[model samples]
Target: MDHTAYIAILSVAFLVLLQHLLGLANRNGKNKSRMRRPPTPPGAIPFLGHLHLIKKPFHATLSRLAERHGPVFFLRLGSRDAVVVTSAALARECFTEHDVAFANRALLPSQRLVTFDGAALGTASYGPHWRDLRRIAVVQLLSARRVGCMSGAVCAEVRAMVRRLHRATTTAGGAVTVELKRRLFELSLSVLMEAIARTKAERPESDADTDMSVEAQEFKQVIDEVFPYVSSVLWDYLPVLRWFDVFGVRNKILAAVSKRDAFLRRLIDAERQRLDDGDHSEKKSMISVLLTLQKLEPEVYTDTMIAAFCSVRDSFVAQAEIDAAVGHSRLINADDLPRLGYLRCIVAETLRLYPAAPLLLPHESSTDCNVGGYDVPRGTALLVNVYAIHRDPAMWEDPGRFLPERFEGGGRAEGLFMAPFGMGRRKCPGEALALQAVGVALGSLIQCFHWGRVGGVEVDMGEGSGLTMPKAVPLEALCSPRAVMQDVLQKL
Candidate 1:
């Protein structure tokens, strides 16, 4: 009797657990009969759901799924429901008509910790707080006029990068094996440092040298630790794993965030002192601009809130374009960038093939919305598959090739559908500044150096797994200063 009773209790408990799981997986259970969800592919487990289907180089996995299931499909990612939109038309619909409904960011576990609990603009929900942050970002920090005013700083950094490469080649007495990824990261970080605090970064002593200032080093380390885990952690999708603090992601992210906040606070204090002393040349730095705003509205832009607002590959059809447009008479300047149309085309095509972030930071729907004629229920996470859309056979001819001419003349995209920086309200506000910096740097490098494969073979273009699509292998090339530009290099 005791054994029979125990077996009956076990069966009852299993039934209850199964029923709860069914409800958890299909939270729309009450309205399931009334609603129309996009088709979910088969082979989902009880607890894992479609998470079992997810694989690394994540956007590629989603693209393949789009091929098997239609362009728009629903996914049960652990407890959350996600709608992955892969077509250009569907991407348009999500960002256009249904944009507001899908404007909020998913409250991912990583974002919750790293972003100061949605205080940062990138992770903030769509509301008054986000509106104010956007206003400040546009009007004060990233305005085109402001970015142009900072072009002098950008030009100076580009010169430094050229000179650094030139010095390395001279030290080697011939073509030096150059790792472009590390050099480029330092360059970009240097530029960012200059913008943030007007700090002049010491160039890396070698390819293996660490990033800039003590603060900058901490910043770089934090980014390295936090970026890959931000939206992709398994704990973010699974409550049980999160409960166990799987991989120590929560502690790791919080520690990084705390370090960043502390360093930024010190910078803010220093800047505040400089302002009191009437040092205005630093006025162009992003920190200076925000501090100035804080004076007028200290309540709105608290030092804590002030903390929030803070924070690509090269090619050559590029070389020919730079030579024709700017000539070897001098190094390329920010102004010369706009005229190097072919160089811009090269950059555009590269982005089309390998977007920095293949899948956009997930956007959460604030209300029920229609996407590709299917209902996306409120609170569902929206993932726009930019990779798949960019490579669509029907939309692009020979989508696999590195054809830069496709963007030449009339071939310029009708819209930013080739949105490398993303689109809609949350599109990167610093896009203009980024392009300006990239244009000058690429044009200068091509005009200054003769780059060749280290082993007389094609450069490998394998992709690495990250929020930013890094090259699988660091690019090592034999680089020699161009004889044609030696006079210019000597002057610098």
Candidate 2:
């Protein structure tokens, strides 16, 4: 009785174990078969995966890989899987058809550090919070109406910059050699500050103006330093390294964030005080607008979100457009922006050649999707190579040449192929404001000054290493007031 019972129990246990193993094997095989992963480049190594293939100026490296592996290819960087879309067709698919699936941001370590752990509009994941931030950004801060109201501020800043450059020319005793990139950055920052907070950026006679408040100067420096490292930090792809803080990048980022937050707090405090004092004389700053909304929806519009809102050189068919539309009677104003269609084209063209964010803020897929007919798994980091898409020879006739006419009368249509500020639901909301600021500033410069390359040398135009593609060599050029506009310039 004991032998028969033991044998029966053993047989039943063995059958159950065999069935379980067979079911496990079938499930594993089915899962593998269902997932049609995108084509990944060869030479993926253990642990490191394909991270070694990624190099500085990552957009170019990804573009080169796309040339070999195809426009839409998978990459495994450390423990993360990424899909790089380098062609317009694939990019279109990602933004259009698969837009919702890939609407969320890939919150990298560095981005989290700079953005108050994804609290900022640009860094926040796609969700109700993001929607609220975006709504405030679009409807309140960056609407065409709001941007138009702030045009006075933009014009005032541009005029001030022109005056500064004019003073430089007089001081130099002729056409002066000016490093334009720093000036451009200063101009951009000033316009943004004035528009957002109704406060002027006090320039202390030099770029290294010691007279500037420590907080102000430190804030500016943090901005300059943090932007380039936002996406390029080692810990972005290799999260494990963050614990070690091997290069002290985390510490540097923390310090920068602290300074940034402090500076923003000061601005917010000042705005609140002014509001409390009932000084409604000035046009309300963007900060004030957000604060009003914050009172209604405190949960959505936090100080960090308001602070986040507080965040180029270009071409000459542009000049002719400006001349034709604006003439020499008065400096170009935001009112003239609509008529200066060709000038807008030039801006669009410049962005195409050199997008502000070369590898646009990375996006993450919320669900499995198909891009360019390739399977994109959920949680895959999506990098759209705007630099490559903009310059893809397949999409453009003479993609390398600088031709604003390519955008003539069809610039908006061409936006599908170009994404300097990104595309789809998650695209940068500041695009309108940026264009307004840059268009007026660039146009005024061209209208008031005759620009030439210094020493008869070509402008370097080589791209630098940064999230924003700065010039490796800051643009230095010779400048003098246009003879016809001297009267207008002198009045300023």
Model 1, global lDDT:
0.82
Best candidate according to TM-score: 1
Output the lDDT of residue 250, model 2: 78
In candidate 1, position 90 carries an lDDT of: 86
Candidate 1: regions farther than 4 A off: 1-27, 201-211, 311-317, 413-416
Worst 10 residues of 2 by lDDT: 207-216
Across 118-225, the per-residue lDDT of candidate 2 in tens digits comes to: 878887888888898888889998888888889998898788788888878877877998888778877777777777676654455543312223344556687876
**Candidate 1 Cα deviation (angstroms), residue 486:** 0.5
In model 2, the runs with Cα more than 4 Å from the true position are: 1-30, 201-218, 311-317, 411-416
Residue 94 lDDT in candidate 1:
86
